[model samples]
Target: MEILTDYILQFGDLNKQQTDLIASKAKKLDLHKDDYFSEAGKIPKQVGFILEGVFRFCYYNNKGEEITNYFVEEGNFVVDYQKFHTQVIASEYIQAVTDCKILAFSRKDWEDILNTIVGWDKIEAKIYQKCMTQAIERRSPLVSEDATTRYLSFMEEFPKLINRIPLSYVASYLGITQQSLSRVRKNIR
Candidate 1:
């Protein structure tokens, strides 16, 4: 898909042949809301680039309550990076928040690109660093900000997601209760 090729191009140069090799590895998939792209305690088989919709990075607490920590929308890659890289069982879940279209690559296929492409390792590292940096920046506000401020920052940072996803997820991400989120919303307006 053009979307995927364009994204890879942003990180590094690729010839037609290299790009075709990548395209050949991509398997298009559809995931409906509430579907798990990858589940907790299972080894991830493939990594994906979101072509449509949103996904949440979540984990269960000791009491078995699922808490959403991060979200990935269209045009981003979604994976439990450390686990995927080590080929280990993931401790968290990557779940679809809305109907989604994704371009996936199996582990072997991803390794093929790394081995075959001259500068792919560097390119991959850059992409990973960028993703990690963005995650850190998004989370920093939550550590020190109040509930209202956290919600406000969330709205500003992910303006597109505010109306697209369930408010419960927004509440979880903001570290507040749904009732509190509702109160904050009412007070803000």
Candidate 2:
């Protein structure tokens, strides 16, 4: 797919043979809204790149309430990185929030690609760095900022997501309640 090619190109250039190899290993799958790409306690076998729609990464607490962590939309990668890398059970769940098209490659297949392809190893390293940076950035504000400020910052950073995702999940991600989020929105308006 052009989208997959474009995304890969963002990290590094790929030769025709390398690209064809990758294309052969990558599988396209459609997910319905609320369908899970990966669930807690399962070993994540594949890494997915979102070609369309949105996905939410969440975890359930001891109280059995889902705590939203990350949101990935089109052109973004969505995978349980810890589980995928370590071949262990995932601690969080990844679910599609809307109908989604995803390009998936198994961990072994990706590793094989990296070993054989000239630039693929560097691309994988860069992807890991990007993922780590994003993870840190996402957690930093919560530790350093107050709830209202966090909510405001989220609104500013992801203006479109405010309209796309449910307010409840957004509130959970911001460490606030739906009622509190409503108040914050009203005050800002």
Candidate 3:
């Protein structure tokens, strides 16, 4: 809770009252490995900040293969932006790749903060911009790089996660087969 409060403080000033309100409404969530934080076809009624562990944002293709779109690590917010803002069911799933501890804010609480806090709009906008920039960075190497290059970039981008998560998930994120990822790792070594 302190970590989350500190993170929010980075974006804007929060008075004692505001901080207490946020802390009061925020709840802790514990998810075991493979548990889903959110799933396709469901509306996510809360926004979560990862205190510990990793989550993957994934979706099934037409052929039903799960493609990992993004990874949310500790200190990051995990929410389906479109679904959260529009009140629609999500098309993607946020799955815990490891046991997770999260600080979650209910939809109503989130709205309350926005309504009551000063400079929240600016804070929100800054957060959105950061998320957008991260998405763009994650997309660029996939389109422009070869398999080995992509794998290398993944290593650079998620050094901690590379060894923590199953290689299959990492392979999927890199758009390569597990066998290929293994070979790439061997070649690099």
lDDT of each: 0.92, 0.86, 0.89
Model 3 spans > 4 angstroms off:
none
Rate residue 93 of model 1 by lDDT. 92
Q: Tell me the TM-score of model 3.
A: 0.96
Q: Any runs in candidate 1 off by more than 4 Å, and if so which? A: none
Shift in Å, residue 38, candidate 2: 0.7
Which pairs of residues collide in candidate 2? none
Q: Looking at model 3, which ten-residue stretch has the lowest summed lDDT?
A: 124-133
Q: Candidate 3 clashing pairs?
A: none
Residue 9, model 1, lDDT: 92
Ordering by TM-score: 1, 3, 2
Best candidate according to TM-score:
1
Please write out the lDDT profile of model 3 over residues 81-181, one tens digit for every residue: 77987899999999999999998888899889889887887897788778778978987878879998998888888889987898889889888899999
Flag clash pairs in model 1: none
lDDT of 3: 0.89
- Candidate 2 steric clashes: 0
